[model samples]
Target: MPTETEREESWLTRDELEDVRGRVPMLYVIAVPVRVGEAGDLDQVGLLLRASDTGRMERELVAGRVLYHERIRDALVRHLEKDLGPMALPRIPVSPQPLTVAEFFPTPGVTPYHDPRQHAVALVFAVPVHGDCAPQQDALELAWLTPSEAASTDVEAEMAGGHAVLLRQVLAHLGQTL
Candidate 1:
């Protein structure tokens, strides 16, 4: 994880970011890290809790922007480490392509996913983590829920920005469903 100063030096400022966002859709990668048991069954789904701009707690996936010089795999690894801590051993899929793509719009009603900051095109994947996980930085906690529990109405309601939809999609991709 880079410091604020380092991030500032490497990335664009708010105004410059706005200009870029206006020109084209930004690329992003989202990871739904999971925990599988010895039998190769998904035992838990990792959910990240972070404080949103509205000062409320919102559930989200492990996600971040794709850097100019970075590949999708690198971006996925970067975000997983940034949010889940360095100790988390993320098992990235062999394929470079994502299981699904989520188009996030700036307007509330434009899509299932909404990001008021920018129009983000996100490639979403489900990763399996084998080691310790400590939610870092802005994340409040890392909650692991069973597939059924995660699909429950309570969990869905807690997730913001249409991540619940993405969550269900991941489960469906894994051959499980609500």
Candidate 2:
């Protein structure tokens, strides 16, 4: 087994990450936690309330980069649990596939999505969660909003980094027109 230090090396150091960010597009998993109503219909979407690196509060989906040796499904579960707490009970697929691939550009207007830090290609998954989700890490709250409420202009305005666009994509994948 790898030692603790070896395990820690699975993550990129700050300088290493910045150097790589300038060279290539990073792969990330964007997990959108959702709820299924009793009738087997989509109930709500979970959005995290947190402060961005700039100290402005924003709503966001659970997201993170996939480690060098990590599986995509594992990356999804890790980010979901880290942001939504251990009891979030995210439903991960045995054979995972993304609902869509969202490409984020460093330049604005390049796409509907923008990420000023680095160009990233993200695999988007709609994870149906069943258990209680107390916000974890930097998350201040987990808001479960109906599809309509989530797609509202007001809610979209509160989300930076084009997360609202991603949410809309997930909603459309789930058969919600909005």
Candidate 3:
């Protein structure tokens, strides 16, 4: 097994962290890795099932906090690999800009997205993966759903927090009306 120092080197460490969760917002990147058909139409939407901080199973997109010196693209790639298996090859977008910026507030009713843990600002993107995906670490399952199926009320209802809105936004961006 890897030592604590090795693990800490890969991720963040307590000494390098700050208590800025209350004083300021954090930067994050959210990815919606997809598979497309020959015609460039969206074929599948990837969803990750993981245990949230509250210990409940929640459906979430590939998301994580951006480290102090990490670029958004690098963070997206890192988180995607961490959640999806390392074998899962993600096609990071050529453009660095995100599809949307979601602001998650600690308090409810502040926005469509709420993170009771902290106030986070996320740059969301739609990534494409060309390799097989196996859930890793905290992710229990990696589910692939059709655009229409993903937009279904049942699927939306299963999404916790405001990830459902992000899903809808992705569909809309793909020219599909929910």
Candidate 4:
């Protein structure tokens, strides 16, 4: 186990992160928490309403950067707890194969996803959560929508940073097409 000091040291400083972003695409893990029915059918999708860096409120998924020396599953758990509170018991799959890989470019139209801050390559997963969920961190609220509702244009328009696109991909992966 790493000490707290060592863990802190593993994270990049603001300047260092900026420099690194300019030089290479940052790797990220994006977990889409879902509720499955008794038969293992997709029930609802979880989304977080939070204030972005620009101070605008937007809907987003459970996502965060993979820290140095951290496993992708660890990052997913960390981020899920960060936004969804500690009670959100996420069942991470044994396989790390993502439902899809989303490449977010700094420039728009380069891909389905766009991140103006940096080029981010995200491994996306649909994690089934089986515990109480309370919005935490910067999250203002948590919304659970059915697959059809999640795929609606109105909901997509409310999402930022290409999270809506990622959500749609998750829906498709579950055999629930818009």
Count of clashing residue pairs in every prediction: 0, 0, 0, 0
> Compared with the true structure, what per-residue lDDT tens digits does model 2 show for residues 1-178?
8876675445678999999999999999999999999988999999999998989989999999998988999999889999999999988989888999999999999888899999999999999999999999989999999999999999999998789988998999899986
Q: How close is candidate 1 to the true structure, as a TM-score?
A: 0.91
Off by over 4 Å in 4: 1-9
My TM-score estimates for the predictions, one after another, are 0.91, 0.93, 0.88, 0.92
What order do candidates take by lDDT, descending?
A: 2, 1, 4, 3
Q: Which candidate number would show the highest lDDT if scored against the true structure?
A: 2
Residues 65-166 of candidate 1 have per-residue lDDT tens digits of 998878888899899999999999998865666899999999998889998888999999999998899999999999999999888898889888889999
TM-score winner between candidates 3 and 4: 4
lDDT of 3 by residue, 19-58 (tens): 6676788999999989999999999999998887779787
lDDT of the structure predicted as candidate 2: 0.92
Query: Residue 119 in candidate 3 has what lDDT?
Result: 88
Question: How does each model score on lDDT?
Answer: 0.90, 0.92, 0.87, 0.90
**Which candidate order results from sorting by TM-score in descending order?**
2, 4, 1, 3
Locate the minimum summed-lDDT window of 10 residues in model 3. Answer: 7-16
Quote the lDDT for 47 in model 4: 90
What is the lDDT, from 0 to 100, of the residue 137 in candidate 3?
Answer: 92
